[model samples]
Target: MAWFDEVAKFNTPQLRLAHITDCHLFCDIDGEYFAVNTAKHFSSALTHMAQQPLDAVIFGGDLTQDHSFESYLLFAQLIADSPLTCPVFWVPGNHDEISLMQRISGGQIKSAKRLIASGFDILLVNSKGPTPAGWVSEQHINELSEVLAASQQPAVVFCHHNPLPINGYLDKHMLENGPQLLNVLHNSGLVNHLFHGHVHNDYQFKFRSVDILSTPASSVQFTKHSIDWQQQNMGASYRLITLERLNTAEPLCVKSELIWLNE
Candidate 1:
């Protein structure tokens, strides 16, 4: 981990990361488990990723079923097997334990982290609260402001919630301080894209010129633009985040693949 200084420069020229979210991995495949067979799905993803040249694994959130200690252990073990010597940073979700997770996974896994990669700064913010309808604390917001203030280059911000109101119904369930977050991002003008989870559907949109990309669930698929998605089949999928230096531009052009299992 001493190489953190060297690796932060994005000296790789180009980089790739895998974004997987809401795996809800459980030890059991059945027995009213969180989502039966999520572990199997993750195993397939790990194996597939091993064959790729990805640099890192970025977990969006909701990595477990009940935020249990056992589930976190299982997650750590599974990630350890991934073909990654690079960094794999994770933010907290409603289904994850911030306290127990830090005890097991080394240090405190906070709501977010600001990462520098591929000559770009990536900011991760926590969007989960006491419930699925998420919220961010004022303290977290102030800290993120500082993170964004440090650099004036395009960065990718990831969280468990999307900032836009989905059809404007039940918008309260979305990011409580989404406008505030967007205000900062807009002011900075360095935020090129925003990636998020918790919606369970793969979506793409633009937020004040910033691309809003929401990947499909790592263990399920939901109806597009639906309010209540109960009958959706829980298919396994992930995103291959690619940061490309297009024609040698200042800000990296980002592209991603929606890799799906059990199609």
Candidate 2:
């Protein structure tokens, strides 16, 4: 069965959003991981993101390394200092404490799972588990189904873990119930894109006509196809997604570009 019997049509103007993920920040200003200063890299990424004229910014997850209250404070502070004027949205990752994040954000960082922007519905799903692996609970799946059925607009889903395996050591840590999640999306017939983090590498592919995108970390880029943990010197990167509706009778078209902060 197709995900959509008839696609939602729109003639909306272009909507550009910036996506930053896997910040791995720490309470300490000088925290390091595997010899990489995560805080420094995150600052660099923030500096560059502040320069972009974005409609909104989405953090894909892993906002902190220690999941401490101070870490969340730092995340909020950094955004407050940035030149980004648009609304900010975020989902939780394995390294994040969702309640703590919500408490400290003080409405500045919205935890709403759904957003309507430029004629499209953005669905935020929480795929974080108690352990390093990932799972989507029944509650989220039900909420997603309800939201998709309620909206008559093109949709983009964002989560922390990749629903599809990337075929590396990281595969073991992917969403354990990815097939279930995929089934929900395929049945929704409304989702046009899936954006995720966790893998710490850049990847793009199509599944059932939906764009599946994975972004590199804002701290360290992981070496793909490695049997174990490996790091590359690649600088921080983020994704810029442009959504446009050329006609009122056609499906919304999406263009996503991965921007490297080092450049």
Candidate 3:
């Protein structure tokens, strides 16, 4: 059955995307993270997503817990078996091995830094760092600026680390070069939103005109505003982002929601 048949239709020009992050799947199917079965939750989340009409799926990173080859293989296999057949895009999180992911995905999962679709440009940037923290280098900022300069279409940027501090212990692990990156994004008049994963919580805020959003983990959710590691009872969650193409004189309407799996 078609996924969109049950949902209300919109006449406006729009693009719908599924944003699933921080799966943290281990090599074993029975592996658990903080008492929560990672593989089981991931399967449940994918099953829910299969019912949605998604133009694309974005894995914001932290795709594995043990960072094992087997874990990646399982992730790829699950996606191949699921109802989600759209193009998948991914960036490296602090825990990810980009080369291994690329090899395992067999080029089906594109490591595209920039994607143009439905009147908007999506920019994916690598924020992986030597430590658990993340940093967006000056070179990446320059590349983003160049990409934005090359196109007049509005843009949404994605990374594995939160670009702005969330006022918690996780703040120390946020993007080290956040100020520089934010400056570049704000100066670029075309950037509409910035989406990221790392904190394992759902958060939304604005940095100037650019909306900043963070999604919870597909395996487990972390307690918000805690100085220590704390797990929340919330189940696995993902984000749905829709960008509506408006008239030339009006700005594009960007809407998003956090969908959580009960099971």
TM-score of each: 0.84, 0.91, 0.91
lDDT of 1 by residue, 1-263 (tens): 11112223456556788887887866453313334467767767777776778776778888887555677777777767655455566767767776765565542222226566555766767787877777877777777676666655567788888778765333556787777877777778777788888777777877686788887777666566655544355557788888866433666788887887764
What is the RMSD, in Å, between candidate 3 and the native fold over all Cα?
A: 6.1
Cα deviation of 228, candidate 1, in Å: 3.0
Tens digits of lDDT, candidate 3, 1-263 = 21111112223367788888998989998988888888888888887887888777789999889989899998888887777766678888888998887776544465556666556667787889888899877666676787778777687888999988887778888989876787788898988689999999988888887888998899888888888878875888999988777565667677889998876
In candidate 3, which residue pairs clash? none
| TM-score, candidate number 1 | 0.84
| Runs with alpha carbons beyond 4 Å of true place in candidate 1 | 1-10, 27-35, 82-85, 106-112, 168-172, 245-249
Index of the highest-lDDT prediction:
3
Per-candidate clash tally: 3, 2, 0
Candidate 3 is scored at a TM of 0.91
Clashes of 1: 3
